[model samples]
Target: MEQIPKIIEKVSPALVSVVLIKPNKEIQEENQEKDGFVELETGSGFFISDSGLIATNRHVVFEVAGDYWVFWNNKKYFAEVLLRDPDNDVAVLKIKNQGKTPFIKLADSTKLQLGESVVAIGNVLGGLQKTVSSGIISGLSREIMAKDESYNKVFELKNMIQTDAAINPGNSGGPLLNLRGEAIGICTATISDYENIGFAIPSLFVSMAVAEIGAKTKK
Candidate 1:
């Protein structure tokens, strides 16, 4: 409705673009070509709380084994991985220097309905930090394959909310939000042959991951 723009504006501040850097490790092997130590891969993420906690895909930051970085509102800051579950492809990152930021609450994925309008926000090409796309719920209760066997569950993610929201390569790990600006899903996957075919990790999964991170942080 008329509240769409308002809701987007409100949540935009919390959405972030996560950049993974694989610092070139020095090697002793011959015929080694050395480029800059930092190589960049882009993805998106969002804030779940005001305490500098953020959620993103584990694959996005996988194998870095070095420094981690994130971008929000065009500013670059260093971050550290608080926890990661290779099985679920989710990771929790913490930024030490981040100031107070707006965050979204997780919505019940079980309640999501088809044809509901939703917005996707992410950094598409590492430069567009908060790009926005729109679509409607396309289906539910779908499954997606993880990149590797580390996620042994086959990820039969229940109550999925599908959309035609123009998600692209860099859109992974971003927010899939309802019209009310609540996060209903985590931008995760898509069909490459089709336009606007996007799938998201249901928000309930995000809630569980965040709760796990919270519990770990408290100890």
Candidate 2:
């Protein structure tokens, strides 16, 4: 209805597509003749600050020193990792004065209810940019196991949102928005064994982490 246009208008500019170049660990091991090898990785993120602060999943910025880069609007910009908390799968990145930019406002996840209609925006399969998908909140406060035991704290995120929206591989770190276009969650993971099992990091944590990062950066 009228709400759809309103949300998209406010949120679209805040969404950004990110491409990362990570070193290929396997390639480096196999090709000992070369100093290093790298593989390209891409994902999506949303701007949370007008001064160039971005909120994205830790995995989205995955790299080993000198191997990461970011792209938006077809322009490549080098970025510095400001803060990363693998425990929550969250990271804050800074790019020197890319100029004033539109940003997304975070919603209060505590108010989210099951069955509420929501939208997801991300780059799917690293092919398209600013793709939009919609679905209802299928479940809340869900949990999934982690591949690495050390990351259990992050994998145990609470107040998560589940949706049937088609969240593909490159959708990680994108925003799971309410129909109002406010970010209710950060699209994080999915249960691939079944259909439509996408999960997101609730806005509550994203807000807390981003705030802490901002505070720490001041010192």
Candidate 3:
């Protein structure tokens, strides 16, 4: 409790709501010419670099056709997908900034213990923004199967960090922070039939994704 406020203050500024806007299929089919983007889904992400690089789950921004916009610090900005790792359920996005945006530091997840305290921050249910939840690391190096009925796909998420944090819908892609307010994992999924059993992509994978992005940027 003593560290919650400080963690929120230091990290909330980098957290952003990820909104996916797609063409209204129903409206288009009825009119045959109607055109407008509708809010398809909402998730959470965090800036990982001052240059506007963002870290999120690939599922958050994985629409075949849509526009991705980010709401940060009460301002909305257009974002583009920069890198994606579907197997890991990780994605990186880029936004235009004047090089003044704050970012979250990636912690060494290898140092995390099974009982270490952690916090999760994200938009919940596509409407509740900046919701925070805290818990201790419940498990590590877990293997889970995530099924997407909409896309008829099953993703085998490996080496996940399991926590008791309340990760509701729309919390995907958000950051799971250590007590120091450093991002140690990316909140990725929760079992609907279970309680306090949320999972996160360990920061080690995040570091690998970021490194891949950097390598691509250099080319």
List the candidates' TM-scores in order: 0.82, 0.82, 0.91
**Span of 10 residues, lowest total lDDT, candidate 3:** 26-35
Which residue pairs does candidate 3 place in steric collision? Answer: none
Per-residue lDDT of 102-191 in model 1, one digit per residue for the tens?
788889888988899998887644456567788899988876654443334444444556899877665678888898888898887776
Per-candidate alpha-carbon RMSD to the true structure: 3.9, 4.0, 2.7
Ranking by lDDT: 3, 1, 2
Candidate 3 per-residue lDDT, tens place, 121-205, comes to 9853345777889999999999999986558888799999999998876567899999999999999889888899999999888
Give the least accurate 10-residue stretch of model 1, judged by summed lDDT: 148-157
Best by lDDT: 3
- Model 2 CA lDDT for position 148: 31
Report lDDT (CA) for all predictions: 0.75, 0.73, 0.85
Model 3 lDDT on a 0 to 1 scale? 0.85
Name the runs in model 1 displaced over 4 angstroms: 24-37, 124-127, 146-159
Number of clashing residue pairs, candidate 3: 0
Model 2 — which ten-residue stretch has the worst lDDT? 146-155
| 212 Cα displacement, candidate 2 (Å) | 1.5
